[model samples]
Target: MTAITEALRRLPKVELHCHVEGTMRPSTVVELASKNEIELPTSDPTQLYRYTSLDTFLEIFWLVQSVLGDGDDWARLAYESAVDGAEHGLVYRESFFTPARHLDAGQDLGDIVAGLAEGCVAAEEATGVRIMLIADIDRAYGPGPGLEMVQRLVELRRANAPGTDRVLGIGLDSTELGVDPTDFAPAFELAGRSGLRRTSHQGEVTPPTTIRAGVDVLGCERIDHGLSLLDDPELTQRFVDERIPLTVCPNSNIRIANAYPRLELHPYARMRELGLLATLNTDDPALTDLDLTYEYRSVMDAFGYTWDDMVTIALDGVEGSWLDPTDAGALRARITADADQLASSLATG
Candidate 1:
């Protein structure tokens, strides 16, 4: 590996847009498929992830999610996801887990949360890379189920169920088109009332109006994607003024949504230039054959971002995170000090 690439990989990162289910290793998918008795379209795991568009990708994503038959399966997925990320310099993440299909399949939410929490704890012990959960609502399931999921999550928190403490927030993701962001207000409102932080996927392919609704109506503290926020300069300025974070997964947009013709065409640089807290992330790392290392390196390569610029991006990630002020300050200090030491060593060699 190039020296710069290796250095970038060593830089600490905080990921907010990642889906734990999307991080399942290909081999794990095959094994879980077998264990769960779920038939696969292809026996070869390599061919299992091909997709032509976002809709097609969601089909493959759902198939991957279906492999988790029980808490054990969820634990395995969660364990591997965090460990894999830690290898590539992910220090902390607010990872999303959408259990809509599992819920529809009659799996208890408590079991899923407990399993993920168990896996996270094990992974943390192994790597010292912490991961917290965000119980995401799948937009395809509609607002009723979305509200229901939040209600159940509140119950879990009140009951102090396993892993409930690790669950930091609620988010909305999956199938953004043809879905009204306002329709899920009840769900977000309940999450807010229950003291859960909120975020949502918006403006990936939708307009900036929806992005505005995500914040103003649903009270989202962060906006996932928000790719089209620049389309409305007024709203874009508002996000900048308010310092709202946009967890932009540039490669995922290219690989999954085909939003940009190439990485160079992504608006991440512009987002940064506009002073938006657009943090870098890998939405589905394993599925896209990506790691945080490559995510940072590729952005640096594509946008000609210098080491200092990349450091700024990393710091912005901490700012965008839901970490409490004290934790955030500590992490910011850590990143700054580590980056300084790494830069000094790199300059010598």
Candidate 2:
């Protein structure tokens, strides 16, 4: 209902599992591409994000990264993106940042995180939006580099400048093909030892077993793209029982089309019916030509979710994210109060 749309606007949101570079607006991409002296495939930002398959989408995603050539580019995008996120009512966000995915093919990992952290700091100052980074490894690269990336992220978090939430966790991103998350169990063991939280992408383009492997093996506190969990009722029931959060990305799922395809086909409703912990997000906002609002709105429009259901789902994100408990509680309280007041106001009218 239109009331739900207006109500959703009033309720602040917490984003978990968004891709860093994927948050870069197309206009930002164009500007960065020009400064880096790179030729882009399209002048329009919207069209650039219109890729239909995972393969083509990644090609465009990597090409955008190529246009962002240095630490400054990285910082600029991250900071401004924080501003964009804030304008979209984001109080806190957990970003899955993959430094190696765009590491200039031979750059040091330290340099990558350095620029990103600085940008996160600057973004916080500029917008008051708390941004946390999750250093992610491309699973497509096999277990070797994935472990290396996780180790470096742990070191970076340990070596933080203090007073900020710098790096919060480790994530397994990129295309999960023949790569089963269980294969990298040792890497997660190392990440866990360093006090970094963990999560991974699975069951999006694959099967339900991948979701099980991600949970049972990689030791993920939360599961990303767990759309396949529905295929296995046992897993769905377990997820609902265990209350493990699933970060659902409606627009990105539709864009990738390799996963859940259309927004109507997205399983947020069914997951909700089962009482599973389902959190909505835009996996790649820029690549999907979406923001958190668009993703939530699209899901609401397609699934006919009410404002109350949407608010409840938003709260699920706080529980499932890597945010500190105190912060999570505060955010949940605030959003819950706001939602209640908004609904009450409408009811009275």
Candidate 3:
């Protein structure tokens, strides 16, 4: 690898917008499908991820959800996800999972949470990669299901369930076109009362006004796929002023054809330039066939970002994370030290 690519690979990464189910290895998906006698469209793992549009991709995404038969499957996925992320310089991750989908598939919520929690623990022990879960309510299912999911999470916490504490917050994701953020207000409020952090996927394919509602109505602390915020100068300015972090997945954006059709046209660098707390991520690393290191390198190459700029982005991720004050501070210090060393090496060469 070149010096720049090597340095980018060594930088500590904090990924805030990833899905646990989306992290399933293609091979594992096929293996699990065979073991469970689940019929797949194609037995070849490589053919499973082929998609022409967001709706088509969701078809495969939903299909993979069915292959997970029990808690052990979720645990294995969690462990493998952490190990894969660690290989790409991941230090901390706050991943999302669609509980309603699993519940609809005849899987118990407790088993899902416990298995993922167990896997996260094993991952931390094996790779030192800290993992947290965000239970995402599917927007298409409407607010009733969202409220029920929140209650389930509350019950799990009250019971002191094994993986319950690992769940840090709740999120809104999936098919944002027709769903209004305000529709989920009651659910978000319930989560708030139960002490869960809030975030939403807004402005990916929707208009800028959705972002405003996400903040004003849903009380979202951060936004995912907010590339469309630039359409509204006033709202964009407010986000910049408030330091609302936007987790922009460039590769995912290109794949979904939402914001920018080309990498060079991506708004990630512009968001940074305009002082938005923008962080890079691999939205669905396994599905997209990309990782955090590749994300950093690709963005740098496309935007002509230097190592210093990479450090700034890395620091933004640390600041934007939901980590507690003490832990965030320590992670920031560690990232700073690493950046300093990388800077020194680059200067010498």
Candidate 4:
């Protein structure tokens, strides 16, 4: 490997947009399906993730969700995701979990949180990679169920549950095409009142107005897949001025045909040029067949980013994270020190 690729791999990183369900190992999915007697479109693990469209991918995504029958499955998935992330240089992660799906499947919220918390605590102890949860409101289920999910989360917090304590926020995910961000305002408001942070998926396939609604109506603190922000100069300027962080998944966008069809045309580089606090992520590492290291290398090659530019993006991930000020500051300092040392070594070597 070149010095740049090696350095990127060694660099400490943070991921704020990964999905826990989407990170399930392919072998684990096959095993879980067998154990649960769940039928899948394909029994072959290699063939399970092949998808030509977003709709097809969601079909598989839900199929994987079906295999997770109880708290143990959720806990195992959480633990494995952290282990896999640590192998990829992850220092911290905030993963999105769709509780609505599990609840619809007859899983209890408390059990789900307990299981995930167990996995997170063990993973943190073993790998020193801090993992937090973001309970996602499935937009396809509409507003009432979304509101109920947030209320349940509030109740869990009130009870001082183990797993719920790590759930720092609420995120809107799944099938954003027909859904309006405004529809979930009441739920997000409840989350705000309950002391939960807010974020949502917008601008991947939707227009800039959806992003506006997420921020203005839903009070989103960060935006996921916000590629369409480039469409509105005024809105883009506001995001720049406000330093709203966007977690962009380049390969996922290309795979799903949402943004630019080619990696070279992706707006990630332009987003950085516009000073939009853009950070790279693997939205669904297992499904996308990518890791954070590959993302860093892809952007470097696509945008001709130097190691210093990579450092800037890495720091953006730290600053954009939901980590408390004290933890974020310490992480920033460590990353700054390590990155400088790497850059200095590269210069002299």
Task: List, residue by residue over 142-203, the lDDT tens digit for candidate 3.
Answer: 88888888988999899998899999999998887777889999999988888999999998
lDDT of each: 0.94, 0.79, 0.89, 0.89
RMSD of 3: 1.2
Q: After the best TM-score superposition of candidate 3, give how far the Cα of residue 18 lies from its true spot, in angstroms.
A: 0.8
- Pairs with backbone N, CA or C atoms under 3 Å apart (clashes), candidate 2: none
| Model 3 weakest lDDT span, ten residues long | 253-262
Model with the higher TM-score, candidate 1 or 2? 1
Model 3 TM-score is: 0.97
Put down candidate 1 lDDT per residue, 258-331, tens digits, no spaces.
99999999999999999999999999998888899999999999999999999999999999998999999999
Order of all candidates by lDDT, from best down to worst?
1, 4, 3, 2
- Minimal lDDT window, size 10, model 1: 2-11
lDDT per residue (tens digit) for residues 50-155 in model 2: 6768888888777777776777887887888788888777878888777665653776666666677789899898878888888787776778887887776666
Worst 10 residues of 4 by lDDT: 254-263
Q: Which ten residues in a row are the worst by lDDT in model 2?
A: 156-165
Predicted structure 4: clash tally? 0
